[model samples]
Target chain A: MDIVVENLVKRYGNVEAVKGISFSVKHGETFGFLGPNGAGKTTTIYILTTILKPTSGRAIVAGYDVVREPHNVRRHIGVVFQDPSLDDNLTGYENLYIHGKLYGLNNTLLKERIAEVLKFVELYEFKDKCVKSYSGGMRRRLEIARAMLHVPRILFLDEPTLGLDPQTRIHIWDYIKRLKDEHGVTIFLTTHYMEEAEILCNRVAIIDRGKIIALGSPDELKSIIGNDIIYVRVDNNIDVCSKLSIDGIQSCKTIDGETIAIQVRKASEAIPEILRYLEKAEIKVKEVSYRRPSLNDVFIHLTGREIRDSGGGFIDIVRMRHRVR
Target chain B: MMESMYIMIYRQLKRFIRAKSRVVGMILNNILWLVFFGLGWAYTLRGPIASALFRGLDYLAFLLPGIFTTSIFQASFMGGISVIWDKQFGFLKEVLVAPTPRSLTILGRAIGDALVSVVNGLIMLSLGFMLTSHLNPLALPIILVIGLMVALGFTSMGIAIASTMRSPEGFQLIVGLLTLPTTLLSGAMFPLSNAPYWMQLAALVLPLTYAVDLIRFHLVGISFLSSVYWWLTPEIELLLLVIISVILIFIAIEMFKRTTIE
Candidate 1:
């Protein structure tokens, strides 16, 4: 295992940010924590990176205990923080050079690594420009380059493409894929974007309310919600949903006052049975639609709420700042 | 460990050099004080009473050491504001997560800021040296040494304060409250001899007073505190400054260790 977290918990005063979560990552594998904002993803990353101490339990990164042997862990792992951490006063090259030196890289090797990483991130032409002058995407790319300068065994990226344009985000994703493919680096990423997790990670842990509610490969997790979803709009959703325990229906949920979503083996076979059951129950069906289950459906199936709906409140924003910054 | 320290110091130097307006502003502010305040006061105090207070040396020479030491103190203390900047901008995380010892970060910052402070002091010293005939050219090296010590002590003090602050405005406010009184009480603008007993007592405890007196002794062949405490020799004063600097450096390092992300 490259990283092992066992029964880890972190509390800030009265709030438990990370509540007794445990997971492990294999060597050279790309793993991800998929969650909404303020779901303890950043807090967990901080503990594993040895920047924040855990309230209880333990985490071992790169075969070293995070609390007892943080220096060793730090030497072996590289991190790209959720926020921009580069020195805006320095040029892109200077930032990388300083990072390389802090990691105790010798001058000749440091220079070579700087050049290679900068080129890898496609920022070689902007090496001499001050980071303050670089655009947001450029800054993030530079930060990624700086993190990879020493060629650490494990890399942690927190919300790597948050608040970025779609094109820039895909570009960053490409660089991240290259890092794992070419360098054989074990990547541990935390992101709220479902597609980012589905596309980048070999496996993912779905965290919500400070706990990993589901963990598996994206396909495996999606399968947990059943292979297909049937969204049926009816005059009486609760009544129809209560009557949806027919043979083909795997699970049933009332989405709203007028709509209920049904999960089953196959929507083609399940929809006709669900409609007949609703008609037999004297419920008037308004509309019916079926589609393949995505990660969003899995999240709603498990948590009973959309992943994006749990964030964006004023208090959530404050709590997020407290946990991450 | 040493590599981290060197890298931090190198970063500070690079920042100082890149911020050209800041360097020019520091030098210009001190020069304005010397040209207007020093020259103006010198003309008003040309008689016997002024001569007795300054110990028969020109008033500009007496004020020279005070200005030099004050600029170093100001520059060094202001250096701590960078700690707050690092916190606000998120760069502190990078330093904190590095494998190097935590203390080395503050140490490197103090030394780096101290070097910049000394350079600023030297510019003021050189300009003042040309305006006054009482300063000896050979005393320049000794003055530089004294300024460096003062710079380190106050730079450490500044970093300590900054580590606890969250915003630049708050740090600036605290620096304002601190720098004005320390400068005034240390007798950087006037002779402490004719001041009240309380003011003299305050001056005696300030490290800046010792730094000014030592530099003044080398430049104009006199010490202000000698009249008050005849037993407080130059060697003892320098040793006291060294002790104070070391203590402040340790305190700064300890404070930095407690700095949280929030």
Candidate 2:
């Protein structure tokens, strides 16, 4: 493992931000920390990058203990924070140049690396313009350039495409994949976007309330539930689990208001059985559907609620209040 | 370590030079002061008090050095504004995460502000020379060195305060509150000879007083050293200023190390 965190604990006043979370990232692999808002993902990144000290437990990055040898850890890791960190007064080229100097790169190598990284992020032409003038996407690209200047062994990106437009977000995802494929740099990323993690990550750990709820490859986690999910809409708010006669059905769950989710071996067999039961009861079904379980479904199964909704109870109330107001 | 420090210092100096408005503001401030002197005290009395206070031994000449010192002091306090801006913009976190030593970052910013103050001091010196024929060209380098030391000392103090303060508005308010008293008591705006006993006592506690006294001694030959027994020698005042600067630097470094920005 290139990075290992054992029982990491961090607290702010009365709130325990991280409660003894433990995980590790292997070298040359993309590891995703998937979580919703306020789930201690950022705090974990802070500890791993040596920006904040853990109240207890141990974190080692690139073979150096974060607490005892933070400088060494810093040298091996590159980070793109959730917020942009470029100096508005300086040009993009100058920003990368100064960051290279901080890493003690020689002038020739620094210039070469800056050019290469700029081209990698496709910001070569805008290098001379002041960062304040850059668009949000352009600034983000520049930030990626700055982080890659030193060719660090590992790259940590926190919510890399949190608020980016879909097109720009896809572009960033491609850039990240290229970094891992070409340079062989290990990547540790945290994001709320499940599709991103499903596509990019070799392995992922679902974190909630400062604890790892589950950890595995996407396929492995999906296998734990079943192969396919049969979604049936029951009529008249009846109990579908008791009425439906479907074999190989692992469990039945309800979602939203009318949809009943069932995990079964074969969707074709389950759909016919469900139809037959409804026909015998002479009930008019609202709808029927079948699909594989996504990361969102896996998250719901592990946490007993949707990932975004788990801690967004307050946000729901605020929205409801606003709608009423 | 010193090489890295120098690099940090160079970056700061570059930023200061590039800020054209700041340079213009400094020059305009000195010119405004010169205009005040021309209108009020350019030609007054002729005696020891006049020599020491108004015009005999180059009264504006005497006043110029103090103004130079005050400008540097004000520049030091103004450096805190950059730190506050950095916090607001998220650049502070970027700098903090870098492999560079934390002390070097604070020192680099303080030195950057001090570099601007040095430029402002030189500009004031030029204005004084242009307006008065009694200016000594031979003492230029010595005066510049003293100006830098004074700037460094004051800038260190400012960095200490900046690292602890949360907002730019709050920092500016504190700077404004402390600026006039420190400047007046330290003989930057006036001579401390006829000052109240409490003011004189207050002056002794500040590093700027020693700086102003030293610059006044060199430019106008008014010996605050003879008047005050404690800082009667150049060597003693220089040593005291250096010691205070080191203490403030350590405090600033510690503050940088402990603070975490999101």
Candidate 3:
């Protein structure tokens, strides 16, 4: 394993920010922790990066203990934090140069790596511009380039695309993909975007309220809830599925006053049985749709609440500032 | 080990210089003190009757080292504003997460601030020469050395306080509370001898008192503490400044250890 944690806990006063969470990332794998805001994703990353200590547990990064061997862990891991950690006064190249220098990279190697990484991020032409002058997307790209300077074994990204536009987020994701495919570096990422985790992560741990609720590949996780979803908007009485014991109907939920969300083994096989059962009661159906179960469905199935409304919690000012910029 | 130290120093130097407004503002602030503040004080405190009060040297000559030392005090004290800015703006996270000792971070910042303070002192020194025509060319090195000690001593205090402070307003309030009384009590405006016993006792504990007395001795061949206290010659004042700098730097490192912003 490139990263390991055993019962990691972090408590701030009376609030336990992170409960006893245990997980590991394989070498050269892209692992993600997916959660909404205030879900301890960032705190877990802080501990693994050696910036914050765990209250009752420990993590090993790159074979070095995060607490006892922090310096050694630091040497082998790179981090692109969620905040605006770059100096706005410095140009893009200058920022990378300073970061490389801090990592103990000498001037000559720093020069070469700066050239390479800037071009790799496709920010070479804008390298001379001050970060303050760069757009939000450019600044994020530069941070990514800076993190890659020392060529660490594992790169940790805390909400790497928190508040980016669709196009810019895709652009950033392309570079992230290249980091794993081309460089073969292990990537540990934390994000709230379900699609982002599904697309980029090899395996994801769905965390909520300081605990990991479920962990697996995207398909495996979605499979835990059911294979398909049958959503219908019907004007009918409540307890719509009390007597329906169809073979394919796994579970049923009243999504709202006028809609019912059904978890099924196969939507094609299950929706006909559901329609027949409702039709016999002379129910008037407004709309009917069925599709593969999404990660959002999995979250709702496990938590009994939608992912976004589980008190997504505080507004991260750094991401807000990036948006305003 | 030293590589990160040098990198941190370079980062600070580049940051200090690249902010054109700050560079211009620092030089302008230096000029304002020398041309206006120093001259205004000298006019009120000069002439035959005031000669004995100022210890025989003209008030402008006496005010030269005072203003120069004042620049060191203000520049170094305000230098920690960058630390606060870094913390608020999140740039300090980059520095803190790097595999560098916290002491070296404080040290590099202190050295960069001290160098900048010396530059401000030198500019004020030149402006002093223009206004007073009393700068001894031979005293440049001594003025620079004393300026460094003053800068380092105050810069350490400023950074230490900044490490503990959370908000910019809190930093400003605390810095003002600290640097104001110390600058005033160090006898920047009036001679220390003219101050009351209570104020003198207050001034004795301030690093600025030692800085001003050392710079005064070098620039004008006058010593306030050395004349009153036998052990406080120019050499002793320099030693005090050095010790003060070391203690303050240690305090800054200790305080920074408890700072958990990143």
Off by over 4 Å in 3: A232-248, A254-260, A265-290, A309-325
Q: How big is the positional error of residue B54 in model 2, measured in Å on the Cα after superposition?
A: 3.7
Candidate 2 per-residue lDDT over residues A54-158, each given as its tens digit: 999999999999999999999998999887777887789988887887788888998999999999999999999888799888888888888889989999999
Superposed Cα deviation of residue B76, candidate 1 (Å): 0.9
Q: For each candidate, what's the DockQ? A: 0.82, 0.50, 0.75
| Candidate 3 C-alpha lDDT tens digits along B206-258 | 87888888888888778877777788888878887888888988898888766
Candidate 2 residue pairs in backbone clash: none
lDDT of 3: 0.84
lDDT of 1 by residue, A86-179 (tens): 9999999999998998899999999999999999999999999999999999999999998999989999999999988889999999999999
Top model number, lDDT: 1
> RMSD of each candidate?
4.5, 4.1, 4.3
Docking class of 1: high
Best-to-worst order by TM-score is 3, 1, 2
Candidate 1 DockQ, CA atoms: 0.82
Docking outcome class, model 2: medium
TM-score of chain B of each: 0.97, 0.90, 0.93
lDDT of each: 0.87, 0.80, 0.84
